[model samples]
Target: MTKYSSEFKVKLVNEYFDGQISILGLSKKYGMPSKSPIYRWVHEAEANGLNYLITKKSHKEYSQDFKLSVIEYHKLHEISRLDTAIYFKISPSQVNSWIYRYNHYGVIGLRRRPRGRRPLMAKKKKKQTRLNPTKEEKYKQEILDLKAKLHDAEMDRDILKALKTLRENDPNSKKQN
Candidate 1:
């Protein structure tokens, strides 16, 4: 990805401000993928002055003060992921991941690297066991068993009643019904 310098962003914004080109035209002229950042730069420039145009070299040399300031903002402000992402010009998901990592691991979490293996839970297949039957299945099985037992009990009662009637009518009155 081509990282445009802050100065280039400011220049483009200025060109749009001066009525030399529309924001969309300026973006096309500069080969910018989107006009939103340019529009943001223009707004910032108008509010903060032209000094914001100065671009620093791409280096991992953020002062301790800056890092501390960012940490302080994160700690002191209960900002939502979307709000933080908009403020930082990053994706909301990135902000969410950063917050998650920071909460768990502190400052070191902010230094994100490409993820390696998937999390164990995600990588492993979910265990399939009948020991923990779902509610519906358990209820269905209970109903089936109850129905079977009821049928058997009804049959047994019918057979006993028939024997009793037969014994009473028969001449063998000594036999137990």
Candidate 2:
């Protein structure tokens, strides 16, 4: 129910890393309902620290053979996602996703796919509306659409919250005072 700033989360994770306190200790000290978030933050901070020095390019394509090998190695040794990713020089989430795909869809799932925006995303292949709109304009329009959707979702959330409050405050429907 409560959201802490990134700075605050990083501060606590750093303290844990510095041996000033444990995850449970930090959670208890801060009166948090659970220690899981602190643990997650610590892991995230560690991962970021590990990647800080590397100049590795993001979103590199991997061969099907390499993906299969990574998945096989992971299963053969029963290694954690983080450990497998460390061994293969890929992000942990990517390794997990590839494994999930392979498990559900077999080898075909591991085949590389195009990354980034597809040239044709719209359902209709209508002619260009504007006179050769730039790629930046297309991206900006997508961003604006997403923002509007987010705004609408937030309004729905607020309306639901208000309704819940009204229900809680309603009288003569259940136990009387």
The candidate that achieves the highest TM-score relative to the unseen native structure = 2
The global C-alpha lDDT for each of the candidates, from Candidate 1 onward, is 0.60, 0.69
lDDT of 2 by residue, 1-177 (tens): 227765677678778878978899999999999997777566655765633323344647788668867876786666787767766666677888998986765565666676788776778888765244356535544554565567678889999999888888888555866
Per-residue lDDT of candidate 1, residues 64-138 (tens digit) = 234334444454454554445445544445456655754565444444355568665676677875244456535
Candidate 1 collision pairs: none
- List candidate 1 stretches off by more than 4 Å: 5-7, 19-22, 58-68, 74-104, 107-177
The top-ranked prediction according to lDDT is 2
Candidate 1's error at 80, in angstroms?
A: 8.8
**TM-score for predicted model 1 compared with the true structure:** 0.37
lDDT of 2 at 5: 64
